[model samples]
Target chain A: MNNEKIRNLKTHAANIRKGIIEGTYAAGSGHPGGSLSCADIMAYLYFEAMNVDVANPKMLERDRFVMSKGHCAPALYAALAEKGFFPMEDLKTLRHIDSYLQGHPNMDTVPGCDMSTGSLGQGISAAVGMAMAGKLDNMQYRVYAVLGDGELEEGQVWEAAMSAAHYKLDNLLTFVDYNGLQIDGNITEVMNPEPIADKFKAFGWNVLAVNAHNFEEIDNAVTQAKQTNNKPTVIIAHSIKGKDVSFMENEASWHGSAPNKEQKEKAIAELDALLKELGV
Target chain B: MAEKIATRVAYGNALAEFGEDKNIVVLDADLSKSTKTDTFKKKYPERHFNMGIAEGNMMAVAAGMASCGKTVFASTFAMFAAGRAFEQIRNSICYPNLNVKIGATHAGITVGEDGASHQPIEDIALMRSIPNMVVISPSDAVSAFEAVKAAISHSGPVYIRLGRLDVPVIYNKESLDFKLGKGIQLTDGRDVTIIANGLMLPEAIKAQEILKEQGIEARLIDIHTIKPIDKDIIIKAAKETGAIVTAEEHNILGGLGSAVAEVVVQNSPVPIKMVGIEDKFGKSGKPAELMVRYGLTPENIVEKVMAVLAMKK
Candidate 1:
């Protein structure tokens, strides 16, 4: 990982961590373990990779991002707020009655949210639709989606993966957050998709395996995907269950459960220091 | 000769005609031939998308296109469009109030030999339950054409329930009487009101003639729109005519019958007799025979109207 991109990515990741802690703590409920795991990738996409205009969130040709694993909505809502799509204050209302920051992303309610998603295995299909539409419209923008390792157990995800490969959607980029744990325990123990890369290859996709938390590897993977002529790319970024917060990292208990006031304070302190080191 | 036309064919013609303006796009699940959207694919190749049997993805894709300022018409069998993709329709389309047209075919027992599995007897109930969904079931070829046009012209998510068979053409070739969410009264009578939709509209008309022979005055209402269901017309018919009989080629549970009952029972509390397929699965037969077996014939409407009249007396 290069020094500059790494610093920028780490800074964004720390904020995403801060965003998750604050949003979930305020909402009193959310999926934080998965959110923290994708903090780095989401940060990398929004800050370093995606070509989008924050000023015109509805720009027709702007790049699109779909959070296929929508249970981790806190990560996305925080990223979008940080991007100035809405007031950062709105994240405090997560899951509250009449809150635009919902438990799942609603395209109409939340600005810059490309589609409404919460139903597992359905969001990627919507992302595929977006990718297909961009191709049909002859738009130059790319479409990227993030999926959870366990959330991939749903059959529709494979159905969409097969279709994307068959159509040769080169502009589509998908990230599988290879966090071992789901809501219960280890994904391998529950429902193992061990040969996931092979599954993608069989479905005709270009596959890559990398450390998701490493910005240089993620950035390099993104660059490689862009070079491909006519195949949808899948980057299986190996990630921990709950990343960054020392005590919480790789822990399954933090999956959907929010931290207590004391635990929240300790995690926020660690994230704040991490941001300071990156000069954010 | 009343040339035959399936609702799917009428859908393709009307939508293709609307595509001329460049704002409409057709999204299909690879059943374009069965849904008669092949006619549209021929007209505007760029505007039509054959997504190859992915009905759930088709709904979300239509919603995406709708978000990008294009009005999308998604075609599939009624079972898949309404039953398979209900959540997508509810969240992406109806919840946001997007302008996406869901043109579903093969509804009711009129699907005939396809039997219960391919047929969607409960599509109306599924669609009508959504908050902002506009549900329309045109009675014949002419109304199907107009229903497609009206769906595109009007705003929001519209579910156009269609049949797989060639029904009797009831409208004059030049009649442009299609309006959004309004009841079109076909006949007026002081004794009873026969409210009908889809394949049952023709049967209701036949029942009107039969009631006349029996010296019983009957009003016939063509209730094409089931969601913003013509409340003023239904209330007036019930109050002035004394009783109402609802007839639909759908399950009596949550389709047109339930919709009309909700209105009549709340506003007027007039006696209502619902004529439709009861709580039972459908079987393979000729469309005519299946209609009788499902109790969707004109004779069934007459009987139900008489039962309602007896209750009123």
Candidate 2:
């Protein structure tokens, strides 16, 4: 929570955002809006919060992260590359036929991906499983999962939520990227998953809300989630559809579209200016 | 005749027997009693997880547990486990090639009064289509027990189909060699070959007796492992017999019959007949009555054998 740490994380977040735009632009397809929306959270977790080792990606004791909203793989891949899990140059090969970095996070092919997940709702269930595994094995590893606000509409998410509470998986921490906009427009108009925190509360989760773009609030919510006991915690991080990029920010159309050459240049220039402001 | 035991009961007993291993875990989706996983739950409460009525979540949970070095066995009725949670089984378990065994009971029309809604007549076909998925339909209680053991030892996703109706125990447990992808030849003859799995094996055996009386020496094979099927044995049988008849308590379109034909036609061409439900659903009735109505009896197997033999030049 120090100023220096906040500045470092902000720089990392901006770089991750640039990487998201670069990958999506290069691939000519991807969920960029949601990916950019979660860049800060992903940066905070991989760089400051998670206990993963860059050298040994599969270490048994390392904390696990599952991208429940797997369409936002550009954000996760950027964070993993930034954390030295793989090379930064590989981001350009995002969804190519020969590339290991698949359109969705595949654990078998990707180094830092804990589970292969493209389908919504299934990732949180797998995260609950990983948390249960840590508890059953008497290991200290914790599990973290990030879900999109629209992704909460899947019934399987609630099923997994009920199970995490039933099994008392206190070791699990779930984050909902509440960007408010989905592919079809506003989430409320598409399929109202409003009061997401209240729903998780009803399901016996320790619910916390934070400004998803703020490094301090993100850290504070994660600290509180760690302190919570006897129940799983859900940090409902309020985020914009696109966090830093100006033309794409808050636009529902950007939810799954890649930027054109000019748009990519503008987004990268904006991210570079933000990184410079952070004094990185 | 040996004592009859339901394959589900055998599955439960095998789970309990395997519970002594520290790494083995059992999960069920609120149907432990019907699926026979309650026995394992009773013995090892800590290792057992009752996933409530959510079959899809149970599969992914088993996949997660399997990923963390636990030999997980998830049980539910075949209809829910194979049909309801097909995508979960494919993506979470089979796609990852996790060490999870899906022991689904109440397979085929033998689920009886529950009718087509509960009976999973196409589970083998559904499971066989997935990559890295091993499908096994144990014929009798002894082989069902051994199938559980084999599934645990083999590393990858496996679906073990168990029946609700009691089947006459054919193999002696002491002498049973239940290896993965290995077929068990119960009787050897030259006139025709009968490939059967699950509840149809006993009927195939009975049909063999009838064929003997008619001066047709029939060969009988209990195809316990349906996927990664014993292709060598199937090709050998086709070459030696020149005719084949496949029987099962499932749809004729895609079960043991389709699987055997895929191998036989490609490798060793032979005239083949399939004795099963003729691409129709079952109605509420007694298991025996449903078997007769669906043309899944010894008589039907004999008729198919006769028809197949006639077509064999």
Candidate 3:
């Protein structure tokens, strides 16, 4: 990827982070920590990697993205808004009753969302389904999914992983946002999904571990996933619980809790500063 | 008289017939042979997906395929498909109202010898409770084939309950009108109405024969579709007949009995009796013996019809 394109993506990621903080803050009940953690990955997929149409999001040939860790919808919604799927102003309506931006990614209401997913592990299954459909129809479009590291505790993920590999879905790519924090506490303490790459490899996936925050690493992994022809790929992205914000980073308590006004302002300020640093 | 055929075989045959549609894709959770999806699989090997023993994953996969504009039919045993993968069906398929057909075989106590664990006595209840779910329990082979076609033609999530045991066909293919959400009146009477679905329809017909012999003149209605149930026929039957008896191979608590009661109690109150497994489980036995033991026989329907008729004002 070019330096200018990478800079633009970084700027977009920072803005997405801002949107996540703003949305969760406005709703007063949302998952900001995981959302912030996966903001960069969502940014890379929507902005740089996936072939999606902002004008006609329902286009059949467009690549599909399933946010398996659906509680992190704030990140996906924000990325969609930044990618011009919707207006930026709608981000504030995150979990509000009237908002189409639900607590989870609903494919019907949300323009860019390929699958409706909220419950853990099921989204990956949906991704597998989409990939299988694409293969069956002889469609050229690829499928991508984002899963939470904590979400790995669900057995359905393994089942999906097995199916994807069994079907030899090279068109499918998944990212496990290994933030090390779950709703209860540290992922290892609560339920260890470590050796995540090994598990995927065992299940016949082309596995890769990357620094989630690093745009270059994320970009390289996407390229590798596309290159691998026979099997599905899973990029186990090492990330902090909350990447940008000071007190929120690595804090398990922030996993699903919305940021209050003070926390929101601080988080947004940090993101804004990061955006400025990226020369946006 | 129609030939005797198992609903599962009929479903398989229907699926093969429906396989002409390129959009139709079939997935089985390693129960293709039993669920009858193997016919479809054989016909359209590329379109069919054997999802192994993962019902939950199979459901989500079907939902995924449906979302992508493919009409997916995911099949497995009723206990596994409806019971094991309840949440997946609720969240992935029904909630979204995707065009995924859950072809669940071996439903109710007729899944004999496998006993209670294999027999799903509450699959109908589980499916009907969910929103945007069309529940179809065809009476016989002709109806099962027609139901399969109807389900494929209609757009949305449909749960087609198929049985293991061979049931005598009730409807001739040429004359049959297997409309979704509409019940077919087989015999007319004034004493009582016998509403039945799935494998219980023949028994209900037999009960009608017995009722006629006794000068009871019981009406027999085949309620193929359970959810978005044929309310008008049920209400009309309740008003005209004054009493109703619901028969199914499932538990009395839910399934056809509860569904009919829900419609009748609100629209037109009547003396109703349910002929089914009385809040109990099935045991390891022959299909015929199990039917007798579980109170799903013609004698049971006759008894229920008589009981409801007695309570009529």
**DockQ of each model vs. true complex:** 0.50, 0.73, 0.83
> What stretches of model 1 exceed 4 Å from their correct place?
B1-3
Mind giving the per-residue lDDT tens digits that candidate 2 earns over B111-174?
A: 8898889988888889999999999999999999999999988999999999998889999989
State the TM-score, rounded to 2 decimals, of chain A in model 3: 0.98
TM-score list, all predictions? 0.97, 0.98, 0.99
The interface root-mean-square deviation of each model, in the order shown, is 1.9, 0.9, 0.7
List, residue by residue over A1-280, the lDDT tens digit for candidate 2: 8989988888888889988999999999999999999999999999898999988888999999999999999999999998888988899999999999999988888997888887888889889888888998899999999999999999999999999999999999999999999889899999998788789999999999999999889999999989989999999999988889999999999999999999999999998888878776
Q: How many backbone clashes are present in model 1?
A: 0
Question: What is every candidate's alpha-carbon RMSD to the true fold?
Answer: 1.6, 1.1, 1.1
Model 1, range A31-132, lDDT digits (tens) per residue?
899999999898998888887777888888888888888889999988887777887788878889988888988787888887777877777877777777
The Cα error of candidate 2 at residue B103, in Å, is 0.9
Clashes of each: 0, 0, 0
Tell how far residue A204 is off in model 3, in angstroms.
Answer: 0.9
Give lDDT tens digits, candidate 3, residues B19-75: 998999999988888988889888888888889889999999999999999999999
Worst 10 residues of 2 chain A by lDDT: A271-280
Worst 10 residues of 3 chain B by lDDT: B301-310
